[model samples]
Target: MKNLLLTFCLIISLTATAQRYSDQAYLQDRAEKFDLNEETQNIALLQIASDRNKAIKILSENGLLHPYEKKIRKDFEYRPLTDMHIVALSRYQEQFIYLTDKAVLSNAWAGKFYIDHGIQNPKGMAIGADFLTLVAGNSELRVFQNGQKIWNTSVNNLNPIALEYDKTTGHFLILTEDALYQLDLTLKTMEKVYDGSNLTAMCYYNDEIVLGTKDGIQSLNRKTFALNKSNQKLPWTEITSLKNIRGALWFGSTKGAFKLRSDGKYDYYASKRWLVDDHVVDLEKGPDDTVLVLTKEGMSKINFEPMTLAQKADYFQEIQRSRHIRYGFTTDLTLQTPGDLSTGYNHDTDNDGLWTSMYLAGELFRYAVTKSEDAKLNAYEAFEAMERLTSLPDLKGFPARSFERDGYEIGLHANGFSGEWYKKHVEENGRIWRLSDDEIWRWKSTTSSDESCGHFFVYALFAELAPDKAWRDRAIHQIKIEMDHIMDNNWYLVDWNGEPTAWGKWNPKYVNSFPTNVGDRRLNSTLILSFLQTAYHFTTDEKYKKAAEKLIRKYGYDENANRPATTIGFVEGEDLSDKWNHSDDEMYFLTMPGFVNYSFSEEQKTAHFNTVKSHWEVERSEKNPLWNYLFALSGSKNIDSEESAWWLREFPMDLIDWKVDNSHRKDLTKIEPNFRSQTYSEVLPGDERTLHLHNGAYRNNGGSDGNREYAPYIYLLPYWAGRYVDAISAPVPN
Candidate 1:
């Protein structure tokens, strides 16, 4: 009885002290978008080049020119250079030399027509201090100065494929089908420098002239004329173009473009992530230290803008507000045409509640840290969207997975019913949609326990941090009914069909049925306990507290919940244990706040904290900011702060669902496939590989055609949570 009274007093203490979050700022290095934005430029940009200072000049196929400086796109011009068909371009001093299909044209310093060379049948041209070297008619090499052909010559029966003016030697290097020739500045003296066949592109790198061939690249020393093959393995062997930008060797290949890094490995820019298509046409250094990859389809400007963590949060907030929110729910945008943002439209997804809850929770954390009015309104708007989910469904205390207008739910199940799995589970099992009592709306049913985890996460945060007392009380009330529903249904989330949803089982009978190796067994136990604890903490409801105590004391839930993540691996015959479920990791991390913060006793808190730390150890390699910040709630010093910051800094600003394929990369060290599905020894940074939401990051490569855009809540939640928990600070005064 004495122990029982002590347990009751401990529960009371949890209600009093568990809700407060400390407001302390730990300053850390901050790292941090666009409008006319990435989407617009993704469609329009064609050839891209930059000056020595990295100021960008973009040219569309139709001759529109866009000059970019700093972060702003300056004034543009339509067909600014000439009326003739422009084939190529080169920057000389402050002027641009446009090589038209028939002749040559020069643009004035500020984009007006300055002079026309009238050099007929010009194939390409290279500019020098006072003369323009024009390669014409496949064999003729001519030098034009002040709009007059000063000298002209022809190579002996050698078909020129490419031409480059060597700045160091002040001589012209002509690449032919089988040989390279050096022509003097006077356009008279010519010498056969190297005899190599199948050469495709040429560039001057320092003291050597690098030649790209069908096999690989070889550098020819200008002084000795000795050609040496590049020993480093390349991403793609068939090199198409080569450029030496700021002393770095950048090359284009049939597959993609890459830069030879100082470490000998290549920084590959492939797929839609870095280019419009993998078949690259050119490579240039872009404005603000960006990389411009011109592909067969269009051009991609990879920007490396520096920003603070707080600034990054604001940028995503703007993106979410502008594109991702649909009927108050943060959502994915379905693009009708691949890589076209104009064709994007929001549609209902399977995890609507889960996604919105994450986004809402993020806004609340933002409010808690900065107290911005916009954050409050954003949180409130999403809170209303979630409230509607509970009310739309007819079942008492049961929230719908999502809701839509009555007629808009047409072909809802039919749209997804192509396979036997959908037919058997969705069509044969039970009704998945039901019309609301108001007759104006329809709500989806069969909400999973993971959805409940998300719902409870935001609700508890709202109850704890929302400024208005009424709002906090409303959140507390929602938690009470949700908990009561689960408990009333025998520790299961009973659906509209008067049965438990396939994944909503939290009772000990169902959870313990799985072997110890399965993740669901441990995750479900923690989730239900967290739900019960949160309900009791906010509402001071004795029933919720008692139910939690019963689950722990009678069902060995404490032991089940404390199991380390390392034990979870493939169990030979178990279907659920075939691989590590990233979604389960998502559920566990989402449930962490309530699980650790609302512990009924000091001992349980310590045990749960240790469990969290153990789980974090398993996930530390991924360097997930969300998981790191969630673990920071336990007040542990080993939160992997630098890893978390690196993740935040490296995350790509372009959240477009581009088709990213890194399978052909030579740099990645492939590993034996494991239960975790980690394809490499080291995971790539966010911008280098496919960008998935909470359920991704371990895989080396996979993506869709650029047809969707993910809501930024993944970055937002972790960043704001980091700020709220004092793991990060506000912007460092610019």
Candidate 2:
């Protein structure tokens, strides 16, 4: 009866606290509620429209506007598009025609469903000069008029595998393995155009037969029957299909895909960012600057137009609301839905506590400045998720890495997991956790120190700025529990297996073991100082201060805390030298803000302030808006407000992880030694770099792994932080 009553009450409590979010609905409502000049809605919208028009006019006053449409990601809609071995694609006026395997599908406006008119064993197809559809088979050629076969015949002993129509002379051309044939439809005569055995694909351009063959790309003259080779060479071995999209040639081959450059060389588009699969079976350009490619996986649309910054930010926001934000914290994802893109796209995270804490920090700042109730709800939602992490262990204050289903995870399914990992699960309370029989969940054991640092980092912000008294009290309560747990356990986060998780150790044996110049020593020392500062600031507890003083006065940790800002760049033989640790840089900066802001006195504040300033002095060249604004907030001298704003403005509006390489470019500026030892072309990080994690700031050339899309938090954190701190005004929505 006791357990049942407790369970009954717990259900009611959890039910009462759970709040579902409707982001778009809530934001739309909030925008209405916060809409400026609500009494004159038309007048306000008119003014905004005029302002937008003026901005556009000024942008285009001296230059002609090249109209384009940018593609918003619709990850799910393409699912129904299906993986087809697309052999040919062409646009006949308004109709979209494509063939895969032996089937042909015709649609209008690239619609999801085909028009249901199809052909069997379609080896190749094209629209003839007479506007009739011509399809070539293994040994036959057929002409169709308005979905009905008007003509079908066996070509006289010529194995026609591909077809092309010539508008210049009203003729049809055929491609076989070793020869090209030109058929005069008016005269009913066939002429051998080019003699080549390894011919792959052919198209007529400017009255010349442009051919993609095994050796190279060459043109055949009809009258002379002479082959003139271009300087271009095939990047791939076997060119499967050739397409004349808007007069430019696009080629698909076994190795990758290509578009012929004006200089006659081929530009390869093999990277996943460009193609869903590198072994592209087919490609076509559709309306609105859309490049559609087909592979073994499915068809994908590529947007040639780039977005404005505002659009990129909007894209980021939509992705966060729709895809990346899970349980109110930002994390990576493996799969997502398409169509309206209104799915959760939820996935588990190993660093749930850590990642959530950073996102929580962003929302806290956002709500502090904008006073948006939605932002507050978002923050608290994450806060609730985080609170569950700490309390699940029932080990006073030990935080878990994550929680998962009881047996769904096959191995080590202990602690909400099963399978091999179950062996390491330290049974506390009960093995089945009578919370439920089958629904029994487990919190992950052996959480990392970075996760611990992250929790303290956000709790400091929340303790002071939670929108409601309940949230504020919860923040303070969680802070004390976590701090006490660490202090009681002699400053280590004890894991489920009864040992400190690999990175959570901060004892003297761990701290003093590293030489003074070591990065970890400074990093760990800064982390502890910040953690202690945060705990004391929230609880006004003296023990936290005393613990901090002993580390500083006894072990020279304060000196170590000041080491990173001075020691990070261009130096050799210093402990943990040369390799840029962006993650550590992230932690160092993440912690310092709290440590300096909540320092017990002015003297301590000044010293910490200087450390941040020195650090900023070195980091200024990176042109990251987040770091600049953070430095400005930290009281750094000579911090350029315009530079910070420039960083935000220059942030590439496209957040998709397209593998970008500027190393081969003839236009790049000279590379110089920045602090990171990474060669930077004169361009700023925000302007030219790929969409990367915060740690990827210094790397100029690299491909993104996975689907490589990003949550807008990186942009949002800095954009809003600048707005909050008055570093940069938000650009008006266009």
The sequence of per-residue lDDT tens digits that candidate 2 reaches over residues 262-348 is 866555555444554455555555445555554433334544544433344555666676667765657755434321123324455
Q: Candidate 2 — which residues are off by over 4 angstroms?
A: 1-274, 281-283, 294-298, 304-348, 404-441, 495-498, 539-542, 565-582, 599-733
Question: In candidate 2, how many Å is residue 68 off?
Answer: 24
Considering summed lDDT, which 10 consecutive residues are worst modelled in model 1? Answer: 27-36
Candidate of highest lDDT: 1
Task: Score candidate 2 by TM-score against the native.
Answer: 0.58
Task: Please give, for residues 409-510, the per-residue lDDT of candidate 1 as tens digits.
Answer: 634552345466666776566557778889988888878887899999889878767889798788878888888888899988898778898788998999
User: Which candidate comes out best when scored by TM-score?
Assistant: 1
